[model samples]
Each structure stands twice: as structure tokens, then as C-alpha cells.
Target: MLNVSNVSRVFGKKAAVDRISFTVDKPGFVGIIGRSGAGKSTFLRMMNRLTDATSGQIFVDGTDILALKGAAKRAWQGQCAMIFQQFNLVPRMDVASNVMHGVLNRRSTLATMFNLWSEADITRALSILDRLGIAEQAPKRAEALSGGQQQRVAIARALMQDPKIILADEPIASLDPMNAQIVMDALHRIHTEDGRMVIANLHTLDTARRYCDRVIGMRDGRIVFDGTPDLLTTSAARDIYGADASFSEAATSTSIDTLPRDQNYATTLLGA
Candidate 1:
């Protein structure tokens, strides 16, 4: 459902992504894992044209995303929703209103100018909040909710778009252990039951193993490993993360099994 071919992003002399290529089949959960500055986030941003590639191509449902602009670009972006690590909700707005913002592409300037959302649109937004287990918070101000509730509101907003693909950039990064698991489970359920393509940038190797169908590893702006999570053994992690002599052996020894099943897992395993 998504194909990225030889994509590269250069900032002056530095290449954040260098000729990276990968594909995510329909309804697949693909995880991009790497240490900070390994270009995982850059790669995910390029997939939705949030950050354009300096070279090569990205295709969604067989259409070249780089070739689109203006209305075409906006339309394409609406089909692929993004969830940020911070949740990105408007503090003063209620949850229902925040979710309804996802359909701005479908609303006219006049309708939006008056802050008018149709009954059906509001109903759909409420339904999505319910699906994400945040329906009770719909009438509450976004800032009034907990971190986990805010993330669920973000997910509900994404679902309101009815997107074909979801790009989650460290979606669970800021939550507590239980909240992180809740968000991860919600994302997994979306990929499995809703049959939507999910591409997540994850810091925890264990979360990638448990939730992703395939894991892609990057180092120095290049893809070093692209396969099932089981293929990401001790040696593969060393190849992705090891640099200094002292850290090399220790990095490999700290595999997914040794990591905790909490939000601290990312910090402990990836040292992020």
C-alpha cells in the first residue's frame, strides 16, 4: 500500500536519510527503530510529505507523493494521518472539537469560518473517541485530560480523517508505562481490526517486537536491517547502535528480553 524508493533528505552537507527504500503492505504494522539522530523520524516524515525528500520517490496507493502540490498535496496528506509524540491538542478546545479538526479538508472555508461542524461529522468524531476509549472525555477541555487520554484524543482525531495509513512518530514516548501500553494496544488494534497500514517510529525494541509486523533499523542515515522482529537479534542491534568500544558489547547484551515492560524501557534499552 506504500512504497518508498531510494529516498534521501539532505540538509546542506548532511544527509539525514540516504537512499533508503522500504515498503509497507496493506494492513501491516511496520516499525522504524534506531537511536536518536539515526534518521528514523526523518524517514517517517518523508513518507507523508511533511518533509519532502531531496531525491527519489514515495508512493501511496500507487500515486507519487512528490509529484503532488496544493490541493492535490493536501488531499493526499488527508489520506495519511500523523500522530505526534506530544499529542498536539489545542488546550482550550474540547476533545470532540479537536477530533473534528481532522475533517477540515472536507469542510469549506465558510463552514470552518463559522466553526460549524455537521451532526454526522460530530457523531463520527464521538464514535472514534469511543473506539479509542476516550468518549467520556469528549466534552472536557483537552488540557483537563491525562497524558494517556490526550493521546487517545489524538488517535481519535486521526481516525476522524478515515486515513488509509497512520504515521506515528514515537507515539508512546511521553506517557507512563500503563498509558504507553494502552496507546500501543490501541494502535495495534487499529492495524489488525481496522485493516489500516501503520508505520511507527519506536525507541523500544521490545515494543517493536511485540507490536510491529516488521522492524526496520537505521544507522548513519542508511537502512541496515529490514525484516521480522525475530531477525533483530543481539548482533543486529550491535550493528545498529554500537560505536564506542565500551558501549559495543554492552549494547548487544541489553536485548529486548532484559528490558522492562514500561515507559522506561526505551530509556533503559536505547539509552534515549
Candidate 2:
């Protein structure tokens, strides 16, 4: 359903996303795993046109997204929703209102200005929150919620858009182990029940292996490996993080069920 062909992003002399190409088909989950600054986030941004590619093209449903502009570009972006590592919610707004913000592109300016979201739209937003197990927090201020609740709110907001594809950049990065599992479970349910295409940028090899059907590894802005998790051996991890004994050791220690999915925990422990 989504195709990226030879996409590259250069910042002056540095190439952030080098000649990468990948395709996501049907409702399956695909994970892009790599070390920090490995270009996973850049690749995700390019998919939604949040960042422009220096060369090559991206196609969604056979339309060239790279060439899209004006209404077309807005339409394409709306069709592919993004969830950042940071719970990008307006702190003062209610959770329901935050979710409703996802529908801004579909609503009239006057309607949005008046905050006059239709009852059905409101119901759908609440329903999505419920699906993510955050419906009870809908009336609460966004800042009052816990980190996990905030992340779930962010997911609900993305679902409110009725997007065909979801680009999640470390969606479970800040939560605890249980919360991370809950969030991953929500994403899994979305993929299985709703049949939406999901591409997630993950830090741990284990999360990629456990949740994603396919894994794409990046290093130095280039794709180093693209295959199933069962094929990702210790040597492959070494290839991606060569001479970095610490990284190799951590990768070796990663177990599909035991790896810490919490990015904050990993950062605090590994000093990454």
C-alpha cells in the first residue's frame, strides 16, 4: 500500500537518509530498527512528507506523493497519520478535544473555529479513546494524565483521522513495561482488527522481532539488513553497530519477550 523508492535526504554534506527503498503491504506491521541518528526517524518523516526527500519518490495508492502539493499534499498527509515519541498533545486541552484536532482537515474553518465538531465525530473520537483504553480520561486535561495515558491519547488522535497508514516513531518510548505492552497491544489490535498499515521506528531488536512481521535495519543512513527477526543474528547486530562492544552486548542480550521496550529506561540505563 506504500512504496518508497531510492529516497535520500541530505543536510548540506551529510546524508541523513541515504538511498533507502522499502514497501509496506496490506495490514501487517513493519519495524525499522537502528541506533540513534541511524535515519529511522528521518525515513518516517519522509513517508508523511513532513521532511522532503532530496531524491527519488514515494507513492501511496499509486499516486506520487513527492509530486503532490497544495490540496493533494494535505490529503496525502491526512491519509497517513504520525505519532511521535513525545506525546505531542496540547497540555491544556481535554483529551477528546485533542483527538478531535485530528479531523481539522476534514472540517470547515467555521466549524473548527466554533469548536463545533459534530456529535458523531465526537462519538467516534471517544470510541477511539475507549479502544485505546483511555476513554475515561477524555474529559481530563491532557497534562493531568500519566505518560502512558498521554501516549494512548496520541494514538487515539491518530485513529481519529481514519488514516490508511500509521507512522509511529517510537510510540512506546516513554512508558513503563506494562504500559508499553498495552500500547503495543493496542497497535497490534489496530493492525489485526482494523487492517491498517503500521510502520514503527523502534530502538530494540526484540520489539521489532516480537511485534513486527518484518524488520529493516539501518546504519550510517543506509539500510544494512531487511528480513525477518529470526534471520537477525548476533553477527548482524555487530554489522549494524560494529566495534561498539556495548551495543553488541545489549543486542545479544535482547530477548523477544524480555527486552525493555521502554526507551526512557534504556536511555537511563545505557546512557544513550
Candidate 3:
């Protein structure tokens, strides 16, 4: 279980995340939606311990992870893997090696520097890439793959960590509609099939509604709504996006319905 109690992050006098409390006692897909500067990224960063929280505690299975230091903190980070909008793989490295890098914290620096990965780790990385439908690309340089394929490589890297929870910060913000659907499907599959908890920072309401079991709406450093996706009505969206009375839902819609009617394109978006 993950419990965040009154967590806040202050940059000088401004709070990026302010006194927000939340709990996730079950394994499911959660989508955090808000405007560009709505603290969604900061909240996830705090959860991953990438940034220090100015106040309150974050507990995982009863231990206050926020208070952990050194090795203990590193252990916590290992269990909570993070993915980014910009597929943060080493572009110059081969895809398989980049996936193997997931276990760097568990190995000696000398071993990693010398590219001395164990056969078992190599097999595991290959298996993860295959599971994501990208094993054939493993021997290729990461920079050679398309953006969507690169993102899958990033996901494969995260899976190699064997993390209990995956935090994806804008996982598909840079992809086309078909690729976005493909990436979202992978995340949904991870939560449903592997039973690992997934918390994604999403931009489009349509994406969240389609993939997430629960939706959290944030605005100005605070959560304004938390409920099942079905409950995220237009009124709630207006509040989340800070739209006035005349605001059209189109402001936050990214539904593939707007895509071109090309046969191949439609088939791709439909996961054909």
C-alpha cells in the first residue's frame, strides 16, 4: 500500500505540490491529469524520491519512505521504477544494454563500466523486450528505433527492474495517436496482467478515461478530484483544467476519433 499524507514541495515561496494526501491500497492503473504546470510531475517525483518533500510523509507498506536515507532510500527507489516523457535511454547504447542498465544499482560500478552483465540479466532483458514486442530491435542502437519503439524500449528497461510500482510521467505525450494508444495499452497490460501498480501523468482526458481505472485531477498544486474514470464528468474536467463556463471539452480531448480515416491508420490505432 502507498500512502501520502499532506505532502508538499515548495520552491522558494511557491508550492508545486501543496498538502496533498492520497492512498492506493490496491493494484490498478491511475492517471493524473491537469494543465502543464499543475504539479503532477512534482507529485510523482516526490513519490519516486527524486525530489525532497518540504513537508509530510510518504509511507509504503507502513515505512515512511520519505525519511529513508542512503542504501535504504536506494532500495525504495529500486522498487518504485519511473518512466519519463522523453524516453531516457542511452541513445548511443544498444537497446539490450540499455535495458540491462536497470539493474545498475544492484551491481558494482566496475562491472557496469566494463559491460560485464551476467548472462541471466541479459536473458531477462531480452525477455522483457520480447514481451513488449521489441526483442528484434535489442541489438540495434537505441537511437535507430522510432519514437514509439524507443518508448517501448524505455518500458522494457523499467520492467527489467522488477519494480512493484511503475510511475510514468507523460508516457505518451510526444507520440502520435496510434503510438499513444499502443503505449497506453502496454501500461494497462502491465497493471492488469502483471498486477503491478501503475500511476501515469496524462494530458488528455480521453487517454485517461480509456486506460485508467481511476482518475485524479490536479490544479494549482492540489488535487481537485479523485474518482473512478466514469465519475470524471465534464464539470469535473472543467475544474481540473481551470476552464470557464464556456469552455469546450475539446480543450483536453485527444480521442483518436479525430484521426484520419486511412485504413492502415485506423487499423493501427485499433491495435490490429
Candidate 4:
């Protein structure tokens, strides 16, 4: 389980993340929603310990995350995989090589720097690539693939880490609608089939409603709404995004209803 207790991050007069507290005990897909500068990304970064929290504590499965140091901290970071928005892959390296780097956090300095990956690691990388539906791309350069494919490769890299939790920061903000659905589907599959907890910082309400079992809305660095997608009503959305709720809903609907199975639900909740 993951426990966040009144965590906050302050920068001068601005609090990027306020005294927020939440917990995740089940394996499922979670979406963090908010407008830009709403601290969604900051919150995820804090959870991953990519940056430090200003105050309060974060614990994962009885371990004091904020208090951990050195090799222990590195190990924790490796286990909590992060998939970045920019598809952080080596442009020149082949896909398998890039995926192998995911294990570097747990590998020795000499072996990592020398790139002496064991056969087991190579096998693991191939399996992850195949599972993500990109086995053929393993031999290609990461830069050679399209944005959606690159993102899949990034997901593969995360899976290679064998993480219990996957944190995706704006994973699909740059993609077009079709690609966005594919990426979201892959994330959902990871949560359901592999039982890895998936948490994403999402930009659109419709996408969040479609893929996340739970939705969290943040504004000015604080959570304004927290509930299941079924309970995220129109009033709740307006409260979350204020006057821009309708506009956001319009954009989100035009973008996420590729198949329209939830068109009615989304339209009703979107208050369109």
C-alpha cells in the first residue's frame, strides 16, 4: 500500500503541492487531473522521490520513503517505475539496449557503465517488449518509431524494471486521439492483467473517466475532488475546474470517445 500524509512542496510563496493526504491499497488505474500548474506532476514526482517533499511523510508498504537514503533509496526508485512524457529513450540506441538500461538502477556500476547485461536481462526486455505489442520494434532505433510506438517502448522500459507501481506523468498529452486511446488501453491492461498499480497525471476529463477506476482532481496544489468515476458528476467537475469545466469537457469529449461506448455517461457527467 501507498500512504501519503499531509505532503507539501513549497517554492517561495507558491505551494506546488499543498498538505495533501491519500492512500492506494488496491491495484488499479488511477488518474490525477487538474489544469496546468495545478501540481499534478509535482505530486507524482514527490511520490517517486524524483524531488523531495517540503514536509510530511510518504510510506510504501511500511517503509518510510522520505527517510530512506543511498542504495536503499535507489532501490526504491527503481521499483517505482516512472514513464516520462518525453519518452526518455536513447535516440541512437536500439530499443532492446534502451530497455536494458531500466535495470541499471539495480545493477552494478561497472556492469552498467560497461553495458554488460546478462542474458536474463535481455530475455526480460524481449518479453516486456512483446507483452506491450512492440516485439518487432525491439531491433529498431527508438527515434525510428512514431510517437505512439515510442511511448509503448517507454512503457516496455518501465515494465523491464519489474516495478510494483507505474507512475506516468502526462503520458499522452502529445499524441493524437487514436494514439491516445491505444496508450490508455495499454495502461489499463497493465493494471488489470499484471496487477501493477498505475497512476497517471491526465489532462482530459473524458480520458480519465474512460480509463481510471478512480479520479482525483487538484487545483492550486490541493485535491478538490476524490472519488470513483461513477461519482465524478458535473457539479464535481465544475468545482474541480471552475468556469472552464464545460470547455474542458467539450475538448475532452471531442478527443476521447473513439468508440463511444461511454458517450452517454461521459456526456451526462461532462454536463454538455
Candidate 5:
């Protein structure tokens, strides 16, 4: 279980994520929805310590996640995988190679530097791709696949890590509705088939209604609503997103400055 107690992430004087508390004890599909700049991504990033929080307590099971250090911190990240809006694959690399990168943390220091993918790791990567229905593209360049296919490749990479929790930050935001549905299907299948908790930041209410077992609404960095999909009334959505807001309109920021642009960041983001 992931327990968040009075969590807030402040950037200077602005609280990107205000004081919020929630507990996710069940392993299932959860959708987080809100308008643009509602702090959804910030809260998700804070879960993996990708971004720091000004003050808060975060625990997985009984361990204080915020207190971890060194290898322990890396272990915490491995337990929680994250997917991004953009399919962050190495465009120039083969799909199989990109997927194999998921197990970088599991490799030895020398092995990682040499990019030594063991035979078992290669087989596992292929198996994951086959499960996701993309085995045929294994030898192709990641950039050659369609958007939907690329996202599935990303999911396969995440699966390779064997994470306990999967956090998808606006994963389908950049895809068309048809492609988005495919990505969402892959996400749903991952949760149901593996029993890993999936927390996805979603923009569309209809998608949330169709897939999420639970809906958590964020507004101004606070959790305004948390309930089953059926219980998320139209009025509640209005309160969460404000009146006259469309599904595509979300308060998001383009801030990669805080995230390190390195191999470490790439691997950490995958398993967190």
C-alpha cells in the first residue's frame, strides 16, 4: 500500500502540489483527472522522488519511502514503474534494445557500462514484446513504429522491470483517440493481468469512466474527489475541472529542467 500524508511540493512560493493525503491499498486501475496545471504530474513525480516535495510523508507498505538512500532509494524506484506522455524510447535503437534497458538496474556496474544484455534478459524482452503483441517489430527501430505501437513498447519495457506499481503521467495525451484507446487497453491489461497497481493521469472523463476502477480528481494541487468511477458525478467533475472545461484542456507544464537528462534518469523513470 502507498500512503501519502500531508504531501505538498512547493516551487519557491508556489505550491505545485498542495497539502494532500490519500491511501492506495488496493492493486487495480486508478485514474487521476483534473484540468491543466492541476498538479497531477507533480504529485506523480513526487511519488518516485523524481521531483522533491517541500514536506510530506510517503510510505509503501510500512517503509518510509522518503527516508531511503543509496541502493535502497534505487530499490524503491524499481518497485514503482512510471510511463510518460511521450513514448520515451531510444528512437535510434532497436525496439528490443530499448525494452532490454528496463533491467539496467538489475545489471552489474560493469555490465551496465558495457550494455551487456544477458541471453535471459534478451529472451525476457522478446517475451514481453510478444505478450504486448509487438514481437514482430522487435528488430525494427523504435522510431519506425506508430504512436500506439511505441506506447506498447514502452509498457513492455516497464513490464521488464517487474514493478509493483505503475504510474503513467498523461500517457495518452499525445495520441489520437483511437491510438489512445489502444494505449489505455494495454494499461488496463497490464493491471489486470499482473495485479500491479496502475495510477494513470487521464484527461478524458469518458476514458476514466470506461477503464478506471477508481477516480481521483485533483484541483489546484488538492484531491477534490476520490471514489468509484460511477460515483464521480457530472457535478463533481465540474468542481474538479471547473465549468466549461473540455477534456483536452489540462493545466500542465513543460518542465524537464528538474528531471536529470541522463541514463540514470531514464532508467529510474522506467521503474518508478
Candidate 6:
């Protein structure tokens, strides 16, 4: 369970994340939506402890996260896996090696520096890549994969951590619409198959509605709406985007339904 109380992050005169509070007492898929600079990214960073909060507290399973130090803080970070907009893979390294690097935080620095991975770790990494439909690319350099395939590699690396929660900062924002669908489908499958909490920052309303069970809308560092996806109507989205009632929903939609009907397109595109 995750509980955030009055958490805020201020940058000079601006509060990137205001005194925002929310709770996730159950495993589910959550999507955070708003226009750019809505503090969606900052909130996720605070929860991951990448950014310290200016005030208030965050508790995960009843443990005060802000009070943890050193190894305890590192442990907390490990439990909360983060996926960034950029794939963040070592471009020159083979996919398997990059995936094994996920466990480097828990291993000896010297061992990792030499790339001395255990046979079991290698097997596990390959298993994760296979689960994401990229095991064949494990022997190839990270740079050789397509953008979407690279993102899958990134997800495999995150899964290598066996995190209790996954925080994705705009996981599909950089991909083509078809690839975006593929990546979102992978994330949705992970949530359903592992029963883990998945929180993602999404730029489009249709993507959120299609996959997330719950949606949280933030505007100017404050949550303007929080409820089921069905409740995220055009009017609610307008308020979240700070648009007048004349706002067109098309402006915030990615039009995912118009993508190619071929579900295997991602695989074919991978071979391009």
C-alpha cells in the first residue's frame, strides 16, 4: 500500500508538486494525465525518492520513506522500479548485459565493472526478455534495436528488479502510435499477470482510458480529478487541461483505435 500525505516540491517560487495527497491500497493500473508542466513527473520522482519533497511524508506499506537513509534508501529505490521516457539502455552493450545491469545496485561494484554476471542471472535476464518477446535480440547491441524494441528491453530491465511497484514516466510518448500501443499492451499485461501496481504518466486520454483502471489528473501541481477511467469525461479533461468548455477532446487524444489492425505489426516493425 502507498499513502502520500501533503507532499510538495518547490523550485524557487514555483511548486513543481504542491501539497498533493493520494493513496493506493490495492494493486492496479493508474494513469496520471495533464498538460505539460502539470507536476506529473515530479510527483512520480518524489515517490521514487529521486527528488526529495520539501514537506510532508510518503509511506509505503506503513514505512516512512522520507526518513530512510543510506542502504535503507537504496533498498526502497530497488523496490520501486522506474521506467523513463528515454530507454536509458547502455547502447553499446548487448541487451542481456544491459538487463543484468538492473541488479548491479545489489551486487558488488567491482564484479559489475568487469561485467561478471552469474549464469543464473543471465538465465533470469533472458527469461524476462523472452516474456517481453525480445529474447532473440538478447545477443545484439542495445543500439541495434528499434525504439519500441529498446523500450521493451528497458521494461525487461525493470522487471529484472522484481519491483513491488512500477513507475513509468511517459513510457510511450516517444514511440509511433502503433509502437505506443504495443508498449502500453505490454505494460497492461505485466500489471494483470503479476498483479503489481503500475503507475504511468500518459500524454493522451485515450491511452489512459484504454488501459488504466484509475486515472489521476493534475494541473498546476494539484490534482484536479481522481476517479475511474469512465468518469474522465470531456468536461473533466477540459478542467484538467485548463481549457474552456469549448475544448475539443480530439486535441488530447492519440486516436489509438485507428491504428493498423495487424497485431503482429510490432514484430514486423522490429525486423525493419
Top TM-score model: 6
Which ten contiguous residues of candidate 2 have the minimum total lDDT? 263-272
Clashing pairs in 4: none
Cα lDDT of model 4 by residue, 1-272, tens digit: 88889999999989999999988888779899888899999988988888899998998898878887898888888889999899999999999999888888778899977889899999999988777667778889999988888888898888888898999999989887766776777788788889999999998888888889999999899999999988877777777777566765775563656554333432322221
lDDT of each: 0.83, 0.82, 0.87, 0.84, 0.82, 0.89
Q: In order, how many clashes per candidate?
A: 0, 0, 0, 0, 9, 0
- lDDT by residue (1-272, candidate 1, tens digit) is 77889999999999999999887766799998888898988887887778988999888778988889999999888998999999999999999999999998889999988889999998899888777767778899999988878988999999988999999999988877667777787788888889998999987777788889899989989999999989877777877776653464354232333434444523332221
Best-to-worst TM-score order: 6, 3, 4, 2, 1, 5
Segments of candidate 2 deviating more than 4 angstroms? 243-246, 249-256, 259-272
- Give the poorly placed runs of model 4, Cα more than 4 Å off: 260-272
Candidate 3 structure lDDT: 0.87
Cα lDDT of model 5 by residue, 1-272, tens digit: 88899999998888889999988887979899998899999998888878878898898898878778889988878888878889899999999999998878778899878778889999999999877778889999999988878888899888889999999999988876555656676788778888889999988776777789999999999999999989866677777887744432333222222332233422332332
Q: Which ranking of candidates, highest lDDT first? A: 6, 3, 4, 1, 2, 5
Better candidate by TM-score, 4 or 6: 6
Model 4 has a clash total of: 0
Better of 1 and 3 by TM-score: 3
Clashing residue pairs for model 6: none
lDDT of candidate 3 over 1-272, digit per residue (tens)? 98889999999999999999989998889999999999999999988999999999998889999999999999989999999999999999999999998889999989978999999999999998877778889899999988888898899889989999999999988988777777777777778889999999998887788778889999999999999989878888888988862362677777554543333532452342
Q: In candidate 6, what are the lDDT values of residues 78-136, reduced to their tens digit?
A: 89999999999999999999998888899998897788999999999999988788899
Q: What stretches of model 5 exceed 4 Å from their correct place?
A: 244-272
The window of 10 residues in a row where model 4 has the poorest summed lDDT is 263-272
RMSD of each: 5.2, 5.3, 3.0, 5.4, 8.5, 2.0
